[model samples]
Target: MANLDIKIREAELADLELILAFISEKSEFDGVPHLLEATADKLKQTLLFVESPLVRVLLAEVGDTAVGFAMFYASYSSLLAQPCLWLDDLFLQSHFRGMGVGTALLKSLARIAESTNCGRMEWTVNTGNVPGIAFYQKQGARILENIRLCRIDGDAINLLAGQ
Candidate 1:
């Protein structure tokens, strides 16, 4: 891994174009068109959501290029009675891996959480993603065992629309 001169900074509207491009490019590798689910208009709404703290995006810049990014939202757990940062998406281009870009991005999130007095930082990585799981372990993040995630997206609701 080369010495990555990475700068971690909060993203701005000007970053939307690059973010969209990176998201579009990465979907090809993951075989997911998830970005298609987030049009520009939706992103605008996310940044302005009043019910929740606005989703924040952080860009990892290497020299003059943005090689990675992360998007996250904040939430509070009534049971825990504390706030948490829910990481939604994290991506680093293949060429930038093994150079600490991911770690830097994660650290930035931790800083945000600490500065905001958050209680936890959490995210879910696919089980089939062995490398990602290992990386989280390396970062001292333990998996929450015995917990399953249930999701209801547009498709599910669309199917039950007539019911």
Candidate 2:
């Protein structure tokens, strides 16, 4: 049980494949592999090539091996009149779980939020993921039971737009 020196850093364009692999692994872990439609081209265009990427990614590695990633985006809270950091995804390899990698990633995100003067940081977790919920609770995140997530995408978006 040697100490693992985990290093967290902002993702670079060269790490595209590694990021995509982590994303696919996360989707599979969430039991929705079929819903993972992300391609390298899409990731490159949306996350790397954009002038001002709405979404940013952070990678966690132990030495030369990548072990986890956290994807997040900036959001606005009209009521608070301040920016918010919305964590889109946080995933660590199964072997790396409970090894402080997740905590390291979260602490990094918190630092970023504080540095940017964000009003809040938010993300959703599946109710079925008890371990994940517990881990998040340990990290001082409150699980909001009253709020429900809403989404409209794919064909539904077109219909909503009256297209």
RMSD of each: 2.6, 1.1
Return the lDDT, model 1, position 114: 95
The residue-by-residue lDDT of candidate 1 on 1-163, one tens digit each, is 6786899988887787788777776676566775466666667666633355478889999998999889898889888899989998788998888789999999999999999888999888888778888988999999988888888777788887853
Q: Enumerate clash totals for all models, in the order shown.
A: 0, 0
lDDT of 2 by residue, 1-163 (tens): 3379999999999999999999999999999999999999999888945898868999999888999999999999999999999999999998999989999999999999999999999999999999999999999999999999999999999999999
Model 2 CA deviation exceeding 4 Å by range: none
Best by TM-score: 2
Query: Residue 67 CA error for candidate 1 (Å)?
Result: 0.5
Name the lDDT of candidate 2.
0.94
C-alpha RMSD between model 1 and the true structure: 2.6
Top candidate on lDDT is 2
Q: Candidate 1, residue 152: CA error in Å? A: 1.0
**lDDT of model 1, residue 110:** 94
